[model samples]
Target chain A: MNYFDAQTWIGGWPFSFQPAHRAATLARALRGEGIGRALVSPLDAVFAPEPTPANRALLRSCRTLRNLLPVPVINPALANWREQLAVVARDRSVRAIRILPNYHNYALTSSEVEAFVSEIQGRSLRLVISMRLIDERHEYFAMRLTGVPTGQLDRFLERHPDMPVLASGLYRTDLLSLLPRHPNLLADLSFAEWFDIVDQLVRRLGARQLAFASHTPFLITAAALAKLGQVGIGATDLTSIAHRNLERFLKT
Target chain B: MKEDGRGRAEAAELIAEAARFGIEHLVALGDVLVYGRRPAAEQVREINDDTAWLVQTFPGKVSGFCYLNPVLGEREVWREVERCLGWGARGIKLEIANNARDRCMQPVMAAAQAHGLVVLQHAWSMTQIRQRSYHTDPEDAALLAGRHPEVRIVMAHLTGCGIRGILAAKPHPNLFVDTSGAAPEAGILERAVDELGPERILYGSDVPVRDFRVAIARVTGSSLDAETRRRILFENARRLLKLP
Candidate 1:
């Protein structure tokens, strides 16, 4: 069955510039391997001082990719967040706006996060908080960033309980640590690695709480797909993880 | 059943059924958090106690190991290790307490050497996870092995540890890696054999967390020759744990 890559990146990044030429090559390779749809962001979000350029670039390139659905990165903390929203909200092509708190240097507790949440909600857009971009140990030594704190996440969820967030860039332990604290938070398992995170998550948090995210180019798409393929879930559960559930939150 | 210690016991109750899928051994690596980051001597005892119970419960089908954190200092590390060995644990398992090369690890490798215990250190690609402190990157495990060549160190998580990890582990003959943690990478196991050779690899499912079926299949379905496959899947582990 086809799986929707719930988390991905496109366009050249200023920090870790992965040009669409490179991204498209990787996506073309993955499409060869059977990933029909991918929810994409910009690597520029991980590096650039501004999100608009990469956001615009991601928007511009996704039209060429039938399988890729653009998920614009919005820094509600930025003074010109309205312009970013106007860009995204003008078209139904982009489904959700992803926020990178650690990368953007804003706390979920901050006014920008609050305003951003309210605006996304006003436009009836979904929220996705990127908890991390890479494994912490391997993160740039000079650009030390930490995952979003559970306490702040809890508070954010408590305050905005109506919003269903797709928390990408989470490791398995972060998912475990937050599962009991926040029921509204749904995590995409692109980076959660451990002894057997799939089965453990299925037991602790149902498959409904998860979606497939290849994290592509940065990770081997087949290897990531194989990770979920190797999960001992039934065809039904696997169906939800691979495509069905993600299709619900994403723009077709 | 929840996949805690209690859940594993329930898993043991179904060992016969699991055997149809070729699960001949279930290595009881403990629920681990019995001793959190800095485990007390009592907490270590409890972890080993549970390990012992699982080993005895499954008999030939199960092997028990002791988990230690040397950052707690020598006394606590030695006490639980010695007690677990006394209680019939097969080896020692180390988690993210400290890197394998840390001065803190000296006493731990010493204890394993003294007790003739096979030490399983939690290892992953620090290439991606750069924290070298408590997290033992594969290079650090290689450093540990370069120092204590006589003691056996099985670096954990073959996939998370990745190619560079296998290469880091290749220099020291005493260092072995188990096919545990993460889903099986498509070709890393083949790369492991090419780098470390087949004998240095062992088959382990960080079970209840990873799929034993796929973990076993990584070896069982490898591109390696038949003897090497047999060596990786059964013989290597059987020799390591000294299973009858």
Candidate 2:
């Protein structure tokens, strides 16, 4: 199956040593797990004050790797976010704009996010809201951040019903609460887990509503793949979840 | 008799499910949370009986662990352990009944030691949680291992235990960490291998709460070598359970 990882990062993460920090190495790691393409973002942007430099660096690094599509991080809380968006939008390979509401310390319900959503709609770029980067319980003692609240995400999804958004790093319970209400919401399987998880998600939300995500560098890539590969599901549904779902979501 | 047939069918399905993922033997740690923490003696028996049923029904394919509430004190603990032994329980499973360091654990550890049974303690890092008194932290489990050096102990949840938990289990040869609990983080299994050798780490699914395939892949898909993965996934578990 041609797998497309909807959540992956390349760059430095201060908390732990990531062997796949470079774009070439990360791509090779993802490919080893049979992931043909991935929506790549920069880990540097996650902690940076301004995401523009990291965004540009990501676009430059992933330029040669066709399978690694750059998904630039946009911190709308920053006053110069419009320029950041404009710069990353100019890159032809860019398909999605990722926002770290918790890491960037902004509420999804804030006026800044309202305007950010409007700008994303105008640009025809897909929006990926990262609910969390790592499990908060095991986070570094000095720098702990909770996941973006599901209630905030519900309101955000409710406000932008037409804008199809992919919410990454959601737990299984988070997906259960969010997916039913917002049909426009698409989720990745990076964090969602349970017995027969893929089949359960497909049964609950349908295959069209879910996408494959590795949450690479933070999680084992092949572990994420095994969630899909080892499940008892139809080939068509598997293909839809493996790549087709994200492909369709990205196109819109 | 009808219920027995239904249970056998269910057990068959479980074995088949494990077989689908190449899992040969299952260590049935009974639904540890069905009665909530600090289950009554009868509740503990009911849980172990359910496990004993699986072990009796499937013999070689299934190994039973007698779940105990250490707070139940010496008499009840001994009675239940002795009863479970007759039904073929190979290990003792302790959940969040009380902290592992509590005086109540004396009888439970003694029971395990007398019968030559391994002890699987439900342990996680108490760094974030406030309930260290009742909950068994990795540090507490390590203390338990230290107190009873003869007993073989498995500290459950490698991810929840984290780096601190790995370090806590380092000095004690008897304390093994299972690759279960929470989500599969990238480097934890590799880190565990580096800190403690392959034999000290065991593969665990925490099944139903965690996906079996995902848990297995956490070890298989890691940066660890083929031989180390084999030891963690199968050989270590086989040796630990004393499976022929």
Candidate 3:
């Protein structure tokens, strides 16, 4: 079955949109290589504030591509984060709200996001925590983006175990370190690299807890899709990591 | 570079998945540990030990790359190579210890030639990082390839090596770039394919350090043609390592 991408992207004012606006371009590129839908995160969320404007623009651009799903980014650290949360709450079109604690310079331990999590839980909103955005080495020299600390993610999961959060941009070390303790956290298969990520991760966390993320515009869409496509996963496990478990994740 | 007693276990895990995905052959590159602000010979040994263990346990499936320190004396460096060979290591791996063009590399290359082993040097465009003293830019690796024409050299980290690395690698047939490091930059892989062609591009994950699915998938799922993809992903590797 042709799978939908969970961690797609939307961005670009002048050139940033090359990757962001290139979702259809990316979709076409993937189709050339055999990929279908991608649930995207807006570039403005990581690089700009009030991602709604750019996101709205991206949603408009992706009108021709039905496969590109928008998962808007909401910085809980923002002053009007509540307003942003309200916007996502009102707009049923977006399936998930992705958070970048590292890029936003806050810990998951922040009481502010904790309360925001409650509001999200109250509204039954799906939360996808992005542990990182770009490769730490390749990031802008001035930018000091770090992965969400292991202890911080562990505590966040501890405080709210029922929340089925999808943490994209997670490191292999962090995933292995955290998975044994935090069963509630469902990670996107995009950033979790290491050696044999699929088998290692599935054995530890079970394929059901795993979901696919393409991290389009930043990473090769085909590369991300291949993880969900290839690896050692059976057809059943592929169903779960690519869509079934994510479907269950959104349902929760 | 966070460690949680999972690195060793996870290494085996990635190898298994890679094998199933037709990545049957593995090149166990030692986690260079960032040279960690002047890693002593003993620390380097520890890294090599982990790599050697990977190759030894799997024997046929895995090939270990030995880590080196050029700043250290010639004796220590040669000793490490001997130790690695003794432990069944397949080749030598270098990080930002010194530029590949530096005079220190002469001894390292000489030892590699003596041991009848290939040397994989971590290379990237110094244009991005701009730290040339220790880091071996593509230019440095190219210079090394020029210096050691008889000895086989693998320039590690293709995306980090970027356009210039591919260009630097193009002139020398003895030199090859592994499709590892950085996010798969758009067109860089294609550029490498166009310049170096598939035969010169080797597939490496920089595993535990970089994502296998991403790195492997980058080469396998690139914009290049099927024959080129096969060459980069498996054929090239099988030939390079002489694996069956």
Candidate 4:
């Protein structure tokens, strides 16, 4: 199966030893798990005061690696977010721009986010809002970040009903609550887990709303693949979730 | 009879599904949260009876673990432990009824020590929640293991415990950590193996609540060698439960 991971990161995460620290290593690892292409982000960007350098570094690293698509982090809270967005938008391979509301210390409901969304929509670029990269409870003792509030996300989704957004790192409950009301929202299967997760989600929200996400270097890539492969969903639903849905979502 | 039939069918399906993933045995830890954290003695018995039913019905395929609320006093704890032992419970499962460091756990730990039953304690890092009074932190579980060196204890939810939990488990040889709970974060299973060795790490699904395939992949997908994976996935658990 040619899986297109909607969520994955490369670069050192200070808290834990991220195995695939380079794009090539991550690409090789994902390929071993049958993931042909992955939408890549930078782990260093999550903790940086300004994400431009990390985003630049990611684009540089992924330049030669065709299967690794760069998804640069945009911190609208920073003064130079437009410049950051412009730099990444110049790259045709850059299909989506991700924002870390909790890490960047910005409210999803902030005026800056409204403008950022407007700019992203204007440029015809997709938006990927990361709910969290690591599980909040288990983060480093000093770091006290939490997943972006689902309430705020609901409001954001409500505000930008026309802008299609991919919310990564959502728990199963979050997905169930958010996906039903927001037709513009799509979720990655990085953090959403249950016994029969794929089948259950497909039954409730339809397969079109779900996409494959490894959350690699932070989460076990094979675990995500296992969730998708072992479920009893039909070939078409599986195909849609594996790559097709994400493909459509990015194109739109 | 109708409920029993439905339950049997469910159990059979579970076993068959698990078999597809090469799982031969399951440790039935009763719905630990069904009656809330501090379950009454009757509620404890009710949960155990359900687990007992699965054990009795499935025999070798399923092993029963007596779920206990440590706050339920010595008399009730002893009575339930004896009753569960009579029905062939291989271990005692503890949830958030009381902290592992609490005075209430003495009788419960004593019962397991006396009966030669392994204890699986629900432990997570309490740094974020701050509910250590009732919830078992990795430190609390490790302390419990330190207190009773005779009884083997499994600290559940390795991901929740995180790296701090791994270090806390280091000193106590009697303490083992299971690869379960939360998301299967990359490198945690590997870290556990590095710090505690593969023999002390057990593969746990946290199933019905967690996906079986994903849980298995947490170990299988790790960078560990085939031998270490085998130890974590099957051999260690088999040895811990003394399964024939």
Best model number under lDDT: 4
Write down the lDDT that model 3 would get: 0.74
* Model 1 Cα lDDT, one tens digit per residue, B1-244: 0124545556565455457557788677776754456676677677667778777777777777888878889888887787887768778888887778788888888888998899888887765564777788888888999999989889988877777778888889999998876544445677888888888998876665655455666666455689998898789989887877
lDDT of 4 by residue, A1-252 (tens): 889999888888878865857888988888888999999999889888888899999999999998998999999998999999999899888888999999889999999999999999889899999998888887777888889999999999998898899999999999999999999899999999888799899998898889999999888888999998767879999999999989999895
* Residues B151-219 of candidate 2: C-alpha lDDT, one tens digit per residue: 999999999998889999999999998999888887888889999988999999887677878988999
What's each prediction's clash count? 9, 0, 10, 0
What is the iRMSD of the candidate numbered 2? 1.2
Q: Given candidate 3, what's the lDDT at residue B188?
A: 67
Clashing pairs in 1: A13-A17, A137-B129, A137-B130, A137-B131, A138-B128, A138-B129, A138-B130, A196-B209, A196-B210
Candidate 2 or 3, higher DockQ? 2
Candidate 4's C-alpha runs over 4 A off are B1-12
Tell me the lDDT of model 2 at A233: 81
Cα-lDDT of candidate 1: 0.74
Which pairs of residues have clashing backbones in candidate 4? none
* Top-DockQ structure, candidate number: 4
What's the true lDDT of residue B215 in model 2?
88
Candidates 1 and 4 compared: the better one by TM-score is 4
| Error in Å for residue B118 of model 3 | 4.3
Ranking by TM-score: 4, 2, 3, 1
On residues B136-155, what C-alpha lDDT tens digit does candidate 4 reach at each position?
A: 99999999999999999999
